[model samples]
Target: MKINVKLFATFRIGRGKIVYLDYYEGMTVKNIIDELGIKKEEIAIIIVGPHDGTPEKMLTFKVEPNMTVHLFPPVAGG
Candidate 1:
């Protein structure tokens, strides 16, 4: 299955607005993070809803075939 991943702020370094990743059945958010070499501490926010909801762990979190996952890095504004 494939899911849509969105990266924000510093996390968007070499990546564009969104990316599609392939995973096998019964894959969890944790699996995808590991596969992409991303550490939990690096993410500031993790969401399953579109532009809403609380941040959570992707590793233990489960996602469906077409779910949209949003990730952001810690940000500070003056």
Candidate 2:
């Protein structure tokens, strides 16, 4: 299955903003984080779903084909 991945904030320090990955049928958010070399603790938010659909937010959620995943690292603002 092919999914669109968007890395945000600190997650984009080294990697570009977007990447297309060929994931397996039952791949989870953990796999995407590992593949991007980002620690699970580094992720602050995970949005997964179709482009115009309401995203399902959860790290343990199973990623389906053609889903759009947006990964956000911890943010700090004051």
**Best candidate, TM-score:** 2
Stretches of candidate 1 off by over 4 Å are 50-58
Question: Tens digits of per-residue lDDT for model 2 on 1-78?
Answer: 687898887677778889889979888877877787877666666777542222234756788887888987667888
Provide TM-scores for the models.
0.78, 0.80
lDDT per residue as tens, model 1, 1-78: 678888887777777778889856887777766766667778777887643433463556778898888877778788
Q: Lowest summed lDDT over 10 consecutive residues: which window, candidate 2? A: 50-59
Error of 2 at 15 (Å): 1.2
Clashing pairs in 1: 29-58, 30-58, 30-59
Q: What C-alpha RMSD separates each model from the true structure?
A: 2.5, 3.8
Task: Output the TM-score of candidate 1.
Answer: 0.78
Per-candidate total of colliding backbone pairs: 3, 0
